[model samples]
Target: MTVHLQQEQQTMLWTLAMHAHDAASTRPILGDRYAADLLDRVDDPPRLGLSLAGNTPLICARAKLIDDAARAFLARHDEAVVLHLGCGLDSRLLRLDPGPGIRWFDVDQDPVIELRRELYGEREGATSVAASVTDPGWWAQVPDDVPRLVLAEGLLMYLDPEGVHTAVTHALTPGSTLVADTVAPWVTWIAGLQPAMRAADTGFLSSTNDLAAAAGAVNLEDELSLVDATATRTGGLTSTAIRLFALASGGRDAMVLRTYRRP
Candidate 1:
């Protein structure tokens, strides 16, 4: 399909790439069979170019962590609400098919949602909202009494600091949890140098060591990042090199997956 997403919106391609990678990889980290199925229907080229080749492991690992976290959350709360923020063309709802009582909202802008609808038809409990996640109005549509889990995968770095606060703090209610990834400052700088990012006219805008500015009632439960996963997925000299770099650089200065819970 010849979808016309805005330049910034095109970042969804990376998430789609990760899904495809997982489905296509021999020993898939995510084992997202739904991803490969959806990808075959999307009409976009599935192969990663040299410019974006290196991102496969990083993106897939990030997704694997999120998938694990989401599965754990669903296990705890069978009837909880889930917000797949900046959802792109992801097939997460298919992968983590929650219970009958679960309310899942896969959100994104208009064009992306349009494409998503074309590729994947309507489902029973999952709803697709066509709106920018930065906007708080979307929250009004969501019922507030139940617990919620916000999965903001590969999303925070693209938002400004203010946007991050709005998304994490205001968008979520008390008794909810948010699982998101943020690139450290150096990662932001390096992201600007990436040809694929530059080509999409997209670059990281938020880079904070702490995602706590607007986390009034939330506390960080866990902190996981790229280096934590890169070595596990790589082998031989590459695995050693990644582990060594992670050891020296430590955890705080790398791209990370952070889970926060609201009281």
Candidate 2:
């Protein structure tokens, strides 16, 4: 399936990110099926042909944090809804096994969703919607009665600061919880060091050094956490790789695990 260069880049990054998760899940502590599924798709011709390099392990570690957050939500809410914004071609619905009662919405632009529909679109308890995350109308499709667990992995960095604020503000419900990952400003500044990564065509957008502040701008409570990829090695890159990148770039932190809740 041919797509625009930017769209193809996004798909490649997502695929690599999933592979990293699969690599990390080999560790007893982070045995995640979602990671495994991501690894399976890496060889698929349509999603292949991208250079992952050191970013692979970091992607996996980020994915584990998302899995952990999802598990937390599942444990607390019986009839929960998962909104995976900018879902790309990920198969988390199948890997997470949110059960029959749970409702899952995997959303992205129409083109990406169309591809997703062609691939893993037939699962029960899962539905795909074609819409940009910035659109307010997409929220109407989500039922208000059930608690929502929004997973925005690798999506925010592409949006302007205000865009991120808007997406979070509109999506928040009383019991809603958000799990996302973003790069620190320093990391964004030095992203060019990895020449192979530039192919992603990420719109060259990023945010402040602190993600908590970004979340706070939208009235969402924030908690900043670090993913210990070194502890669990499933493996594209490791915490050491992240640290090395930070060191090479004169950065204090590279990636962050951000959780948000409405007060």
Candidate 3:
């Protein structure tokens, strides 16, 4: 039951990210089933069941990486707000115990939001908004006075360069910090090699050779880190597929984590 949306590719990645989280939670890597159930709510049960048998390890690894970052942010800030831009069915709010002080917003398309509502009962301190991240209106609901930690996992590659810029710029507040994961441009070419990947979505690979430049475009002071899932043996289907893709595409494109903050 694939639900096609304006950004279909991005949606698929979001689902994939959720699946990864589910794998991690159920298997005790992250030590909870909350995130897994959140993912289960939206996933095509039969299709995911088949994939899990073979890809659980990969999925768990990717989930752990994302969970680690989310956990770290919650740990450091008592009043932090987590804005999961393009958040599909991820239940990070359920997975991390935020001590009743943190707020979590899950933003995505209307249909996705509806699906989440139907599948998972809403919890306290967690809200879902149906809006594009590029739209400025969504910010009205977020408290501007407090610190915000924005997570854009597997999101930017499907947005045009300008759209990504606008989303980052509009989402940024004086105390905002952004945690994003993206691939290098060459990785995009490699991603196209897999037939399954090519069928997923619409958007340009707006990644740059210099992640700092991309972040700077949105007025964020960027600190970039490399993420080689292969080196860490934590590569998921997408990560492994991207690695094979890099070989096929004939380049050295790498995965990266770019953290943006205001200086």
C-alpha lDDT of candidate 2 relative to the true structure: 0.65
Better of 1 and 2 by lDDT: 1
Candidate 3, after superposition: displacement of residue 43 in Å? 8.1
Ten residues in sequence with the least summed lDDT for candidate 1: 208-217
Q: Report lDDT per candidate.
A: 0.79, 0.65, 0.63
Candidate 2 lDDT tens digits, 1-263:
45443633365445644464445644533344454544454453333333454345556566666887798788888798899998886656766788766899998888777767765647888888888888898888798788888998888877777777778776666767788777777667666554444555444357544345556644544544343453345334555554555455434345677777764
Q: What is the lDDT of candidate 1?
A: 0.79
Clashes of 2: 6
Residue 121 lDDT (model 3): 66
User: How do the candidates rank by TM-score, highest first?
Assistant: 1, 2, 3
**Better candidate by TM-score, 2 or 3:** 2
lDDT per residue (tens digit) for residues 1-263 in model 1: 66577677877766686767766877666677777666666566545677576667778788888989999988898688899998998888887778898999999889988888998889999899998887988789987888899999888888888888888875557888988888777888888998877888889988655365666556888887677686798777756776777777644348878888876
Per-model RMSD to reference: 1.9, 4.1, 4.7
Off by over 4 Å in 3: 1-62, 201-204, 209-211, 217-230, 233-253
Alpha-carbon TM-score of each model against the true structure: 0.93, 0.78, 0.75
